[model samples]
Target: MKRLVRLATLAACLFATGTVALAQPAAAAPKTLRYSFPIAETGFDPVPISDLYSLTVVAGIFEAPLEFAFLARPVRMRPNTAAAMPEVSADFRTFTFRIKPGIYFAADPAFKGKRRELVAADYVYSVKRHYDPRGKAGRLYRLESAKILGLSELRARALKERKPFDYDAPVEGLRTLDRYTFQVKLAEPSPRFLYVFADGSLTGAVAREVVEFYGDRIGEHPVGTGPFKLGAWKRSSSIVLERNPGYREVLYDEEAPAGDERLQAVVREFKGRRLPLVDRVQISIIEEPQPRWLSFLNEEQDVAENVPAEFANVAFPNNELAPNLAKRGILMLRYPRSDVAYSYFAMENPVVGGYEPHKVALRRAIALAVDVEREIRLVRGGQAVPAQSIVGPESWGFDAAYKSEMGDYDPARAKALLDMHGYVDRDGDGWREQPDGSPLLLEYSTQPDQQSRKLTELWKKNMDAIGIRIVFKAAKWPEQLKASRAGKLMMWGVGWSAEQPDGDTFLAVGYGPNKGQSNHARFDMQAFNALYEKQAALPDGPERQAAMDAAKKLMIAYMPYKVHVHRIWTDLAQPWVSGYSRNIFVREFWKYVDIDREALARRGS
Candidate 1:
């Protein structure tokens, strides 16, 4: 009887333990968002890297003083780390900013167990890093005309001494009045300077300790105070970014203009919610279009940012979501890109790059021969529009009614111009020769890809029609870019996306000082340079517009760059992805994106 009583006691104890175990809560599963990049990101450092892919990744890991409103239609600037908008002087040369307190950088070894709170001095240091000649920042020319007081002298001194840049050196243009207040003084009136800051160029604050710790490997070691931190990177294959656990609590809020139904719905869904809804992000680099498209269709990726032109018909019929994809609850968002794709004639090259009348006529003839409409229809699957000028449609100085001869397609006019310039088939070879009887064969650099091949064939046909001989040189995109920068390639095709909504952003590429950097053409026109400077000093009004128009006309007349087409991109998102919107001016939309884990699991995505 005693043994039976003990057994009953043990059984009762087991039942109680079981009950307690069932009452406890379960741990939540992690939420992750998967995506892909058509090209591998170059690196994390923002100073030397100018590619859009790298900038997009950098945006997540860095916080700028100012940022674009997340959901604004017209796209307005707002304070991100700043307490308020900058205080600008009447002359628009001096601007002061106050940063918000309590913001801390992500914990790193460089911090050495000390809290790294962001202060005004951090911004000053970050800007100075770009001026370091050793860094060789790609976008340094953007600030060349700004002429920050004492900055040029500092750079000169550093070059003369051949020593490390003195970060502690005081520059009058960049001053920290206090712990939170920072002032920027420009030599000339620069109304668009704030826009440059609002973009990622000058906004990201780099702690001096972090830079010192990383040294030469700073590109690989990116440390910033943003929503996400770098998790893992496999050179050219994949990248992962995890949520910053120490990130400050910030809710999603924006003052969007009313009467937009789509934006209203987005606001209702995410207005008060905490940002960075997704816990993790996975990026796969799939260079080939077929594999990338297959991965997206197989539900491995949540978003496909750019639909390949070859699959445009299959993805979007009549520019709307295909019936099949729509049936699967997939969403398609279309936006006209604020970008331009063009070919640059290396003005430094002996054969093609010259300001002589015949050379100019030859370039004009080649530009007039190529039919942009046919190229768009056949090669791009109706995904682009003929670009009128260097400035795209969304920018301020883009004139819709402005017409030019450079963009026109006239084979007869092309042949006539070539013949008038003494270019003729002298050796009965059916190809034109220079007036001096030298073989006039143009070498064009292009990537070895299906799209590039198609474009090359079209170019060959156009050149043949005009009795001009051309040879195609295949090289990787980066290789081609390097060759163009070194002034080795005669001509090459490239594209530029606007970092800000200003015409100057596009015009700066042709500016003389930007040569060997942004200006691949190496075009140095005295008149165009003067107009560029004049426009930079004026505000976005009639005077500035006139100056910009004159510059555009000059660019077209010289034919240094044959501006081709502006793309219309169709972006796709899986059903499980929400709050996904396309912003041309901003690429860092991961924080605003959310993943429906339950729905993803239900669809087996």
Candidate 2:
């Protein structure tokens, strides 16, 4: 009887333990969002010199002076802190912005515990910073300040007189008429001027004190009038953004067309019910593609911006989520690409004098003989789309019909073309030569990555069947960029991506004056330049569209670069996230997003 009593006591203890375990509430999941990128940022500050990598990462933590949003089915432009949108003159040369009455920055130790309100003078100061010849602000060079009144002259004078690039000159271009109102004058009427202001480039406002304090290293320790402040930046690790308490919730004009109905509905559903959705956004640097994919699958990462081409198909379902993710995948989204690639004959330049005329002919014949479709399918593995026009599909004027007839894969025709060009083995040596008896050998430059290695091997096989002997030289990204920029490539590969939605970004790179900046092909033409210049001059509507189309047609005729693939970026993230879109490349989720943990649970339910 005593043993039975002990056994009962043991059973009672086990029941009590199980009840406690079941009764205890589940631990609340920490309110954290984790994101990943393929590359590491050089710094937390985004300056043009640091390249686009750091700039994109930094742009998130720092806020620009103006912001863009969709209203009534079109993109609407608004100032970050203002009662209403700015008023612009009919010609779009002069813009007047009125600062709101009570908005101010949150108290930071750096600001000496004072909440500094933004003013019109701050805008003037920021624009002038770009004009500074110190080359401190890279985006300023992109602004084409020449379009702005006297601002261009100041930049030119700074260059010629050996004075620092100064926007302090009393010019017609920019002025603070009063504390609230500021005016910007332009050289010519630009219909897209408002859009430019809306863009992050001109909109980011900074305090003059902060600007003077940091001076050269401002890109590293940026101070801006945005909703979030840069908390910490540890290189090759992560960047953090802390929400500013002084941040005013943004509201748009109900009557505005850019106020999207669908987005409004979503916002209304979450209003007041689940406020301040996301507490923090932690963007982690994950360089390896496989690790990033694994992190996304494991739910450790809230968003994987760039899904590897190989894993995208396996991980994403063929549903709205996948399609939405695909649309959002375009990171650092730019519309005009600055780089292009093409096969060049070294014989054209005497520096590569070793390549005989017959060998050159054989190479050119091989260009027409190779099958681009097979190359795209077998090598690219359906991740990229074939290219016919020098312009990528993301560009404004790319037409698909231009690729109809570039000649198919026919080894017989390749040999015949070579034979017709007088390339033959006259001495019974295995290698063919020109009529003048030079060896028909070619050298191709490429990188040492998996895709490149496979593509190069396939190209060699194709060339071999047509009696052409090719050599492959593997170089790093830097070496490849330099060689291509110098026009030293015989036949090589490169990729082009854009940042803004304009044709000029693609065509302007190859233009005569700016050739060094982007035109890797070294291709030049007066007529093409004229068309492109005219297109850039037009406003961003149908008229501009027509001009761009003509320019793209001419570009397609030249075939400066063969398009290998066009990718619609595919990204994956949890459903709790909101306010993220595919149209623009923005990393800060706190600025635009409001998450609902309960809603996410409901979604799963």
Global lDDT scores for all candidate models: 0.86, 0.58
* 350-401: candidate 1 lDDT, tens digit per residue: 8888999999998999999988998898888889989878988788898878
lDDT of 2 by residue, 1-605 (tens): 99999999999999999999999999976466678755555544333332345555555544455555432223345555545687878766777777776666545555777888877787777677666667434345345622777876787798899976665679787888898778877776665555445444344566767756676666667666555566777766787666555666654232323455545665565444332345566777765566777887666776666466456455553313455444543122112222333344333333222234544445446765566667655664444555554555544565556553233456786688678877777877666676567776778787666567777888788777776778999875556655665667766666555444444556654454444335555556677777766776666778777777676665444444444445446555566665444443232434445555775566435
List runs of model 2 lying over 4 Å from the truth.
1-30, 44-53, 70-79, 101-110, 136-141, 201-203, 251-265, 272-276, 317-381, 390-502, 513-525, 540-543, 557-561, 578-581, 585-590, 598-605
lDDT of 1 at 140: 75
The per-residue C-alpha lDDT of model 2 at residue 60 equals 50
C-alpha lDDT (0 to 100) for residue 20 of candidate 2: 97
- Assess every candidate by TM-score: 0.96, 0.72
